[model samples]
Target: MAAPLAKEQILDTAEEVLRRFGLEKASVVDVARALGVSHGTLYRHFPSKSALREAVGERWLKRVSIPLAEIVKESGSSMEKLQKWFQTLIHTKRSKAIEDPELFSMYNALAEESVEGITAHINELIQQLTEIIEEGIRKNEFKRSDAGQVAAGIFYGTARFHHPALAKEWTSPNIDEEFRLVWNLLLSGLKF
Candidate 1:
């Protein structure tokens, strides 16, 4: 009987296979070879290459989400949290699961999967920001009427303006500068 593959072991093998061969060429067979496992054994755990790919992506997202949640929780201000959230998005935008924006989009299109956990994560931020905006409206810190839309607009709109592609290979120096610049442009009118 073959011993079960550990989750980390499986992911490591999958990552090596993907990185070496590219996502298109990397197959369950490749991962099995990398892990010294039989196809049947690997299939017992992952069913197919796509399933493994999704599992790997899910694990990676969980890794990033934990820290982003921490940053949002620890940030002192809603606006500060928003900036931190943008930083987190930019970082996530450059992960292995999304090596190329076009490739990632194609994967999304094929899988019909929505990165909605991310949208949910941003929703949490929006709720937090809504409260802040509400407080600001009362105290004249911000304008009122549609804090939720405004929050969504700031988030998605900024995300649209600074598409992950624009970040270019993750270390693009434009990320922070772009965030601050966009925030400044939006904040003036947004402020009370």
Candidate 2:
């Protein structure tokens, strides 16, 4: 007999179904059908279609956060870590958009409908930023300030480089230069 499907397997197939059919057309039935199972079985894993979409969004956002979180823990000057963190974030988002335009579009649509998951993802990213800022302050690399607030400022201030809404602009030749200018300005504010 085939092994019982796992939650990850369901999410994986759901993502494929989303990619194949796009967000508006994709449904729990589609995911189940793709997995060769009944919708009821998929429903056991995700109580509703909205819940499944949110879970998929959460999973995708986690992929983005995991690398940033590693940068936060690395043994380095916070300045280096901070720069690397944002660079990784921008690269990840841009590559995902470039590598799979359909999947990228689906994620943006899901993000719009999955506010709770998106908010949680944002909070997790902010918390990661907060840890890096706190370390910098502790090391005297950054001026004394509220780490959480500064982290939020950094995140929002650099939004154009990483935000999904601005994905199209990421392909512009000037995008890297623009990010460098913003990064330098934010760095100046953080340093003594």
Candidate 3:
């Protein structure tokens, strides 16, 4: 009898295969081969190729989300926390796009195809922002009728800075300066 393969091991190898061949060319067979397992073995873990791709996307997003979650939990003025959260998000997204472009592209392709995972991730991010906005309102630091709505607006308005598809524009020399301008606009509206 063979030992069971770890799901993380499969996902790690799958990510590598996806990075090497991309979403259009990669397959579960390639992942299984890379991991020294049969397609059947990998299927037991992932169910389907789309599922595997979604898992990879989810893993990458989770890495970005952890620090943002920490930022949300930290002791600080809501304004400070909001600024730091946006900065960290932009930094993380830009780092992923610039430092490991191939992997970033793979995730982007997978994300476009697999909306369920990415939608859930985006919602979680908005939820995090909503909590921060709510905190600000509670502390009398911000004036807004709806934290959820404001969070969604903030997330969408700042998409150019962090969205993978918009990464090309981020390479411009003045991206940071542009971000500050946007941040100030958002801050002014949030503050009483």
Candidate 4:
């Protein structure tokens, strides 16, 4: 007979593996060995390494996604929504996942490579921002412009939308102040 792993324990082990070695090294055998669990035990819950990685990605979204949606939804204006999103990005930048330079670099590589649905993630962000901008345009609050281009510009400010660790230190101010300044300038250019 064998002991069972608590779901949390499995997830924690998976995250730790990803943090240290990233996707390539975060193999099933690696995670199982790291947790001192048998391969059979890990396979019982996660059929494969991709399955475990997906779970971790899902956890990452759970930690950051809803709050992001809420702030954008509740904002009094689209510009405010944009600003709030940037602020939230900063807070998430401090997350353990993002704090690890190697992990972050791995993410950057993935984003550029479109690995792990990385392009899908960026497309989602662009779509969300486009919707907000469209709403603002409808309300006569924003000048007519290409939402995709605007989204790309914001990406520039955030280091192609990578966040604090990925950005040049001189390219952006400290998070909150930097976001406020970014919104200030952006609004001036965007307002009707």
Candidate 5:
């Protein structure tokens, strides 16, 4: 008999199944079949199809957030860290959209279905941005302002480059130049 499937393994298989079948048609049974397990076995780990889908969405969001969190902890001036953070965020989103369009679509669909998970993911990102802004304030690198508000502004300000809904536009030749213009504008506002 095969070893009992780990939850992470189930999530991994489910992601693959979703990629193959697309979100609307990919059922819990599909993931179970992919894993060579009975659907009931997956139920032991994920409870329901919705629960499993939520876990997959949460996992995908974490893949993006975890790396950004590391950038937050790294040693750098606030300005440098903030630039790197945004660059990384744009690159991550762009690559996923360009390289794996189907999977990227699946992720967007999962995001729609998992509102609470998406909210938490957005909150975590804003909190990371807030930390960077607070550091800039402490070091006198940025003007004194509400860090959370500034963070949210910076996030929404750059949404054109990073937002999933705008993924198709990311492939434009001028997207990077446009981002630089926006970044410079935001930087001017942040500086003392």
Candidate 6:
């Protein structure tokens, strides 16, 4: 007999199901069947389909956030750190969009439906940026008086690169050059 599925195993299988069938068609039953169990078994791990989708979205964002968090912790001039952080976000988003457009589409849909998880993830990202900006301010490298506001502006200003709605634009031939221009402009504004 198949062993009872662990929650992490269920989430992993759910991700594959979502990837294979897409979020709209994937369901708790599908996940259970993939795991050789019943929908009731899956429910014990995720109370509802929405909860499962939220977990999937949370997992996707974690994959992106971990590296960014590491970059945030590295000791470097704020200018260097900020540049790398922005570039990392752009690169990560663009890579996901290009490498797995289908999965990216599923995530975009899930992000819309799983508001709470995505919202918290975004808030955490903004807070991370705020910390980096605060570091810069303390070092007298940036002129921003409000790190939170500055971080939000930075996130929004670079929305073209990271925003899922604008994913298609990341394929532009001059995207790198365009990002470089935007990065330079942002740095110029932030410099003391």
- For candidate 1, write residues 49-81 as lDDT tens digits: 767887766555465456666664563565566
Candidate 4 achieves a global lDDT of 0.66
Query: In candidate 4, what are the lDDT values of residues 120-156, reduced to their tens digit?
Result: 5656666666777777787778888887787767666
Off by over 4 Å in 1: 1-3, 91-142, 145-147, 160-162, 165-179
Candidate-wise lDDT, in order: 0.64, 0.92, 0.88, 0.66, 0.93, 0.86
Q: Runs in model 6 with CA error above 4 Å?
A: 1-4
Model 2 poorest ten-residue lDDT run = 108-117
Tell me each candidate's RMSD, in Å, in order. Answer: 4.7, 1.1, 1.4, 4.4, 1.1, 1.5
What lDDT score is found at residue 49 in candidate 6?
Answer: 91
Clashing pairs for predicted structure model 3, backbone only: none
| Comparing 3 and 6 on lDDT, the stronger one | 3
Candidate maximizing lDDT: 5
Q: How do the residues 1-192 of candidate 6 rate in per-residue lDDT, one tens digit apiece? A: 767777788889999998888777888889889988889988888889989888878888888888889888999898888888888988888888999898888887877777777788789888889999999999999995899999999988988888889999999999889988998898888996
The predicted structure with the larger TM-score, 3 or 4, is: 3
lDDT of 3: 0.88
Task: Name the weakest run of 10 consecutive residues (lDDT summed) in model 3.
Answer: 106-115
lDDT of 3 at 121: 85
Collision pairs in model 4: none
Q: In model 6, where is the ten-residue run with the lowest total lDDT?
A: 108-117
Worst 10 residues of 4 by lDDT: 161-170
lDDT of 2: 0.92
lDDT of 5 by residue, 1-192 (tens): 789999999999999998888888999999988988899999999899999998998899999999999999998799999999999999998999999998898898887788888889989999999999999999999999999999999999999999999998999999999999999999999998
Candidate 2's displacement at residue 97, Å, is 1.2
For model 3, the superposed segments whose C-alpha errors exceed 4 Å read: none
Please write out the lDDT profile of model 2 over residues 1-192, one tens digit for every residue.
778889999999999998888888998999989999899988888899999998888888899999999999999899999999999999999999999887888887777787888898899999999999999999999999999999999999999999999899999999999999999999999999
Using lDDT as the measure, what is the rank order of every candidate, best first? 5, 2, 3, 6, 4, 1
Q: Tell how far residue 26 is off in model 4, in angstroms.
A: 5.3
